[model samples]
Target: MSQIIIDQLTHAQKVRILYKTILRLHRGLPEELRDLGDKYARDEFRRHLQCSPMEAQLFMTEWAKYAVTITSQLGLKGKAMGTIGGELDSNTVEMLKEDQVIQLYELMLAAKGLEGDTITAKDIHNSK
Candidate 1:
């Protein structure tokens, strides 16, 4: 379908955009979904990369999905944290905070097309 094509393009663009953003954010795509975590996932990703093209495609697709989901939630969470007067300091440790984690997640998600534009707590609340 044409919609699917459009969707694919959107995702591709998101991935490219997020690639740079992720570098700045100090977060890489989650390793678990990318099969880059533990021995199994890493092995799987490697095997896919070395073997069947379809498998490679699947691997990338899964990573993109994971990235998007994580980023969107991260952004939403960050907005919430900001409301409470909490500020995130620069460091990987700070990434553990729910709000900071969410913002990182949002940046990734926007790159993947899971969500777009800036979101606010009210936007999230209204949606639900």
Candidate 2:
């Protein structure tokens, strides 16, 4: 069934799907590593943009397999990153609890122009 659907999709559509899936997987990574993962994924995709149709198809197939494996290994569901639709699921919510904390810490660091330092009361007070 899925193979039928895949066959029907245009090459561009397949590329779009693969790109979105990779981005979603990157989003689920720990905050500190997200940027690195995103850059690597983006560069790899860009590098393949000029490949022949057959090469593109082969790359997409392999990428799709890697995406599924990574998602499973990370205990993430298809809905985990809310990339397909803009709605969160229970599993996504649970996953976000820890991610949210890391995101917040990252945001705070960016806000204060600091790198890899825990925000302490003294740091906040000194900044003011």
Candidate 3:
């Protein structure tokens, strides 16, 4: 049977959980691309792949472009800003099911107050 995640979190727990998951998705990219994604993001890469340097340099540049687009579209900011997504900010994830983690990320984005354009994990954590 398939499991539905995110059925286990509180409203506050949901946003943070989602942000961490998305950030992980971003960190999974190749090193070169990951670096670029950290700087510029993925969408930017699509527009300027030629401007990128050859080999690893080119990889980082292009990948950054990809990272940016993904983060922006996903409503992620800061470390979450580029291709690498965002950082994990909570311990609650271990308590939830795997699918719940995914759902939490989506819900965080879908939540009304959580839809701001500049929310970062640090900001969320520091506020507490």
Whose TM-score is greatest here?
2
TM-score per candidate? 0.29, 0.52, 0.23
Query: What overall lDDT goes with each candidate model?
Result: 0.46, 0.65, 0.46
Tens-digit lDDT track of model 2 for 3-106: 99989988888788888888887676666556755765687689888999887877788688768765764544433442321233556445444445455456
How displaced is residue 19 in candidate 1, in Å? 7.0
For every candidate in turn, the CA RMSD to the true structure comes to 16.5, 13.2, 19.0
The clash count for each model shown is 12, 0, 24
Model 2 scores a C-alpha lDDT of: 0.65
lDDT of 3: 0.46
Winner on TM-score (1 vs 3): 1
Arranged by TM-score with the best first, the candidates are 2, 1, 3
- Give the top-scoring candidate (lDDT): 2
lDDT of 1 by residue, 1-128 (tens): 36676476763464454454433222333433222223333344445545566755665676556445545644443321222112335564343555545555564565465766676667444532
Worst 10 residues of 3 by lDDT: 76-85
Worst 10-residue lDDT window, candidate 2: 78-87
Q: Quote model 1's TM-score.
A: 0.29
Name the weakest run of 10 consecutive residues (lDDT summed) in model 1: 77-86
